[model samples]
Target: MPKSSLVAALSALALTGCSHADDGGPAAIAARAPLQWRSMATPHDRDRLRDWRKAWKTALPRARAFAPERTAAEGALFNADLALPGATPPIGEYRCRTFKLGAAGPAMLDFIAYPWFRCRVTDEGEALGFYKVSGSQRPVGLILRDSPTRAVFLGTLVLGDEQAALQYGADPNRDMAGFIKRVGDRRWRLALPYPHYESLLDVIELVPADSARETP
Candidate 1:
């Protein structure tokens, strides 16, 4: 069966509403995760999702080694433990950029930052949709509320020539999970760790396009 079909089938059996219990590991934390994410992430990815700090610890120092000045200049963009309240970003266009840290392979750069691109956040009833509309590699996913300080990001990447994104569980290699948090009044970030790609940690900084110039 297709992953999307399987997800739909299984979702029928999983608890449909929020569960206040925080025990019994990732599967038990239904209230904090989207339906697709809870069903799709591997045990290891779930651990990565819950304890994302490990990825930060592993990546930040390596990035700093390569570009201390640049890394330092990023400030909260590079801070792993700086999530603030009001994790959801308002629906609208945003100026976003990718900052990769800790190369996964010897041939890749330890730290690399990309220029700003366009992204959007949409209200999807059960969750908010986040899509990077500009870039060779784009991320499109649902942002489900996790806590007052953060939200769970469950989505997949859209590579060149792809007209539409794959279902979150369709391809484990393309699957992306992370935390979205508000770092400042109008600044938000999606922090993905130990991605199935070149970087150990990928931070996507987002700010309202209209107010990008005022970001501090």
Candidate 2:
């Protein structure tokens, strides 16, 4: 999916009454400051698989016992220009950054705000999908820290009616607890499972060219 399409899909979701304006103030203010989207950086290592597993262990203590059993075929590797269903056109680019998690290990973080979409089977085996436009419901964004550990963290902002969001967030079937128990802290993790291998685009700020700008 193109970045424009992703944005359109997300906007449509919002229009469908999936999100409520922040209760603090005027709706216009809320419109000006939409959600923000970002992802954790990718670690650079000769043994990425090993690092991933280690990270997962740090974040998820019971990973060996509770983590979803995924074959290499089931795992999807994402690039800077990955696209998904319902993505907006003109997918944006991304800025990758690396961070250190102290003794826990080195982590990578990427801040992206472009058109992206994802449809995945949550750890609990339920279907979870999203069409992301500008920002993300997840605060810290998606974290893919250690390779050997295969630790991953995701923060999301709940969209849609309170009931729907809450229901998904609290879904027991999804293996959300294992993921959250390892990484959930100041940033809350939804009890619901999130789709894996969702599509994503680059990050780009929307700004009209000077030629298209009106004269002052």
Candidate 3:
């Protein structure tokens, strides 16, 4: 299929509703979140999060080969093992940008850098609510505290003007799982490995929205 047609098809799928036994409201979503979030992710996502280091290793050089300046500018963001101690970010608005590395197919670009977008980290009783408020493909979900240096992000993508997001485990195609880590003083990164889209890994760099209105 042509690229436009493929995108249109994906948008259609995002708007369609599918019944799921596990799908429920926010409270219910939080209730199932504990250690169960790991099981909620697809098998591939599980492996992706587990072998995230490999994803970075395979993607960085490939991305550098094509967009060396852009890739090099990322600096510490590309370091897979540079996670800081405090993985949890405070409740507030954040400025985030996306860097997609390693093309998944011939039609995709080797590296793509998206401009700044608005994101929010809310205090959702059981887990923090992470929402990419502005973007064509928004990911809204719960951030469960996993360890001292990391947190597990379990969420699904919301496309276009869709008001509702799919349940995390409802659709494999829409499901998103990643690890959130604080990389700098007030900077954090969400590392999503082996995504189901155009890139092998998706790194979202985030910082307080109050900072300079530029890339994080």
**Whole-model Cα lDDT of every candidate shown, in order:** 0.77, 0.24, 0.77
Q: Residue by residue across 138-190, what tens digits does model 1's lDDT show?
A: 98877777788988787778998787777555578987889999988799989
lDDT of 1 at 158: 90
TM-score of each: 0.82, 0.21, 0.82
| Alpha-carbon deviation at 95 in model 1, angstroms | 0.9
Q: In candidate 1, how many Å is residue 83 off?
A: 1.4
Model 1 error, position 32 (Å): 16
Q: Which candidate model has the greater TM-score, 1 or 3?
A: 3
Off by over 4 Å in 2: 1-26, 37-69, 75-163, 167-216
Best-fitting candidate, measured by TM-score? 3
Pairs that collide, model 1: none
Worst 10 residues of 3 by lDDT: 1-10
Q: Report, for all candidates in order, the number of backbone clashes.
A: 0, 56, 0
